[model samples]
Target: MLQKILRIPWIARRTNHNILQELGMKESQLLKNIKQLKLKYFGHVVRHNNLERLCLEGAVEGRRGRGRPRRRWTQDISDWLGFSVREASILSQDRDGFRSAVWEATSYSYKDPP
Candidate 1:
């Protein structure tokens, strides 16, 4: 539906396809909520005993895969912010700035697990 609206050629074999933003529409509000939560969780001021913090920051061991590895949330967040993990951590501390950045980033249509 979006492709037809955007007039993107079907055979172009393109990627990074953000049709909603192109049409001056906002990405889903849920995505904004997720982004806000991720940023806040990663930048918590104190230890909150939150499982998500550990899960997001922890590295799993003994991973074996035949093909491509699983796409990680951290990796996606980094990609969305155009930042290294360390940089993202630093920037996530600023709630207002990070919110704006999230709004800008949700416009990117990069296919997942890139």
Candidate 2:
């Protein structure tokens, strides 16, 4: 889509990185933003003692299906923060700490062209 917008043909051999650089875009901008938002929302939900939190924590029991186990939302949060879901939940209690952790977890640093 970007290539079409830029009128660059496939035969031009223009790399995606080059195109993104031309457009002044960080490659991970969209993904990073999504991660940041997800983390922040998770923190919000964790701070509350509601149905949402219970569901997120897998406290609401239900039947399991056959084959591979489904991945949980907290798993993604744990992967991103390099901490267990329980620890992350505890940290989320501290608003400032959670915010800083989310920022650090999702931040992307773009290197200047040489």
Candidate 3:
């Protein structure tokens, strides 16, 4: 069910409604599950304001005259990570290699606590 939603490029509120209709589950229930999963895997970072803005911007777009843009479920990291893993595997030799590359690209390093 989650996989189905992740496959869509831009899942709107209406798309969720149709999905819920087909699955015989309430939208609220699905949302609750997503929230729970996010909390369990992502911790409080999922609730940060920056993440919220990124999610809203990535997931939705407003029409020229529409009231507001709708959030696309695919914008969420959980949804995108599935695809990212596959792409990462194809582009790199190993996870450690990818991590090193990322550190080099971003010029970021971790220091041990004193």
TM-score of candidate 2 against the unseen true structure: 0.68
What TM-score does structure 1 among the candidates reach? 0.50
Clash pairs (backbone) in predicted model 3:
59-72
Question: What is the Cα-based lDDT of residue 35 in candidate 3?
Answer: 48
Worst 10 residues of 2 by lDDT: 105-114
Give the clashing residue pairs of candidate 1, or none. none
Q: All candidates' TM-scores?
A: 0.50, 0.68, 0.27
Tens digit per residue, CA lDDT, model 2, 2-113: 8998899999999988998988887687568779989999999999999888788666458788999889877899999999999998999999998889988886455522
Best by lDDT: 2
The residue-by-residue lDDT of candidate 3 on 3-31, one tens digit each, is 35456545344465666677687765555
Cα lDDT of model 1 by residue, 24-104, tens digit: 654554466677677555556313446766676677699677889878767877876788877766676676776677667
Candidate 1 — which residues are off by over 4 angstroms? 1-49, 107-114
What local distance difference test score does each model get? Answer: 0.64, 0.85, 0.45
